[model samples]
Target: MSRNLDLDLIRTFVAVADSGSMTVAANLLHMTQGAVSQQVKRLEDVLDCLLFVRKTRKLELSREGEAFLVKARQLLRLNDEIWADMTGQPLRGALRVGVPYDLVTRLAPAMKAFAEAHPHVDISLVCAASPELSDAVDSGHVDVSLLEYVASEAAGEVVGIEPLVWVNGRGSDAWRKRPLPLSMVDEHCAFRQVVLGALADKGIAWRTVFESGNIEATAATVRAGLAITAWLASTVPVGVEMLTPEATGLPALPAFAICLRFPATVQPAAQEFARYARESMANEPGTRRAQLANIA
Candidate 1:
């Protein structure tokens, strides 16, 4: 119950454990690597144990750290429950949520409906890339998140998976003859590697006409006929035509997973809200229409 063992240190500990590196953990926590390391060192000093061992290229958790992870997560969960109860209103604590821009279009109506149903529960949504979203959930900045991840031991339940397609501007038929200029998100994106690997296997020539971490920018470049881009078929922007192999001669890419994860501290209301959101998306129409009405 000491102030030194507060939730901030616990969160830093969790982020370091999950990311296995101080730098990546820093990016996830929105802090500097030195700050994160200093905090971790401070926590270790208070606990009187080293939580991690610095390996050649990785941060390996000590046995003590491994053992502490379970309890640490539980402590974080209990903290959230306490905050929810002591706020003096019925389930009136904030629910931090992490979601992608495309997924948000689909989640809006469901969240609105949930807000209407539970007026007391405050919700805070942090829009970010899939990597950041997953890291935020792992760090306990958010109780639950929707992320784009492949099947892994770390991944949780699958919310949805959509096939990817090459899309180009409506009037640009340049891709109809040969491999084309490509606009894409940065290497940190889960789908970026998938698309590049597919093109590599097919011996398709491509140049990086534009690269950005922002999905909106990539979509805009694709719309402007600047370059060809790959995106989830369901989330493809309007006014872009899907290029076909027969018509544009590009091989098809496989679908990617969109996963949902819950932090160890997720409450009953958050759980209920996640369920309602999923159910709402199940019945909604395609992403294009859902986005236009802002009711996804």
Candidate 2:
């Protein structure tokens, strides 16, 4: 006999995987923590495998669980699309979304969900620096923009808050150099100015050894132990580990608001995209997704 995977169980698993804590996932899912734990257990039993390895502070995916996550996401996406098709009028249109290069991957879940739900809507993703994205939003070239901005400077709805963090290769001592070596994006990157200002205010000497528009290049430099880099905590790549400010003697960096921007007269498709993006990104740790009012 074949067993079908329960999407509810899979959703709970994905929520826990994203937040790393059942309590946070519970809050996001509006379920009790114990209930969330039970669902995970039930899923594991159904699969006849352990899905998570519980650490002292968080739940991590075992190798088997990690493999299942991708399939789980696909199943949910298809399910969501089918449900949307059955329940609502399919809106036909196109949407251009502006996103920072570092955030493109972060937008994947929202993008896929949105695309699946609105199959008739075409989406064009414009990857650029935050500042450029801001310009695109202002000029009306982009229908919606996800931005990284100083809290006080955010002109759009603040959807989430993400603290900046220092990251280097696992076990790399590159941060110990007197004049710290650095890998970063160019002036167009929104983080460049904020990160440099923090270091300067700390009276720390630093030098930029690598600078490019490619985020992967910067991540590779840090992963190779050639230099250290800073990024929003959630967007840090896999090979690098975030260094504790206290342990590394690095200055604490400021948090940036993840803002959503679009003109007041945007199309129904744009508004629809915003709603999906907001809901999808809400569960991320430190984000205030629950507090956002419905987009006007």
Candidate 3:
């Protein structure tokens, strides 16, 4: 006889995996932490495999857990699709969304979930710099936009704050250059503005060695040890090390606000998309802490 997997248990597991904390998953699911733990244990028992490697302060997925996560997400998505098909009005519309280039990777899971839940909604994604995204939202060129701005200048629902930090290739001597070689995006980039202003304020002589609208190219430049760049602590690409201001003698950068801007008349599809994005960002690993730390 084969045992059926409980949808509730699977949901609890996914929540825990996504949030990386039992307490957070419990709050999100409106269940006690003990209940969440029990559900996880029950799921593990059914699979006869340990899902998470319990650490002192964090929970990491074992190989088994990582493999299970992919299947679990698929199952949950299909379940949601079936339920939505059976018991609700189907959503059908076009939503044009603008997102900053750096945040696209961070928001991928949320976008995937939204796509799975609303198959009929046509989503057009526009990836650009923050200023361009904001302009798109203001000009009605896009239905919604996820943008980054200086905290004091932001005007939307603040989702999170990302700490700005200098980044360079790991094990590279790029920081020791007399006139620092800098890599940056285009002039309209908020990060570029902040980085340049910080360097100028500190009287640090720097020269732009690479400039591109492409984040990958800029990160590649940094990774090649040709230049150093600044990015959100969380968004720093792989193979790069975040530099400490004190040790590197670089000016400290203030946090940047991550926010959502939408048109006044939001369609149902757009509203649902926004809601999902908000919830995903809230539960996103590291986002909650940043949000809490930057509350002002």
Provide TM-scores for the models. Answer: 0.63, 0.65, 0.66
Whole-model lDDT, candidate 1? 0.73
TM-score of 2: 0.65
Instruction: Give lDDT: candidate 2, residue 197.
Output: 89
Q: Which is the better candidate, 2 or 3, if ranked by TM-score?
A: 3
Error of 1 at 135 (Å): 1.7
lDDT of 1 by residue, 108-224 (tens): 887898888778889888887788787677667787777776433234456675566778988986464355688877656666777788778888877888888677888888888
lDDT of 3 by residue, 185-257 (tens): 7767888878888889998989989888789999988999999988877777778888887888888888888
Best by TM-score: 3
What's model 1's lDDT at 101? 63
lDDT for each candidate structure: 0.73, 0.78, 0.79
Better model by lDDT: candidate 2 vs candidate 3? 3
Residues 1-296 of candidate 2 have per-residue lDDT tens digits of 87688877887887776557788778667789999999999998988899889899878889998888778756765675566568777777889999888888878888999898789999999988988987676556788889898765654556777677788899899999969998986668888888888889888899988999898888889999999998877787788888877888888877778887763234567767877788766756443222111100
- After superposition, the stretches of candidate 2 with alpha carbons farther than 4 Å from their true spots are 1-89, 285-296
RMSD of each: 8.3, 15.5, 14.3
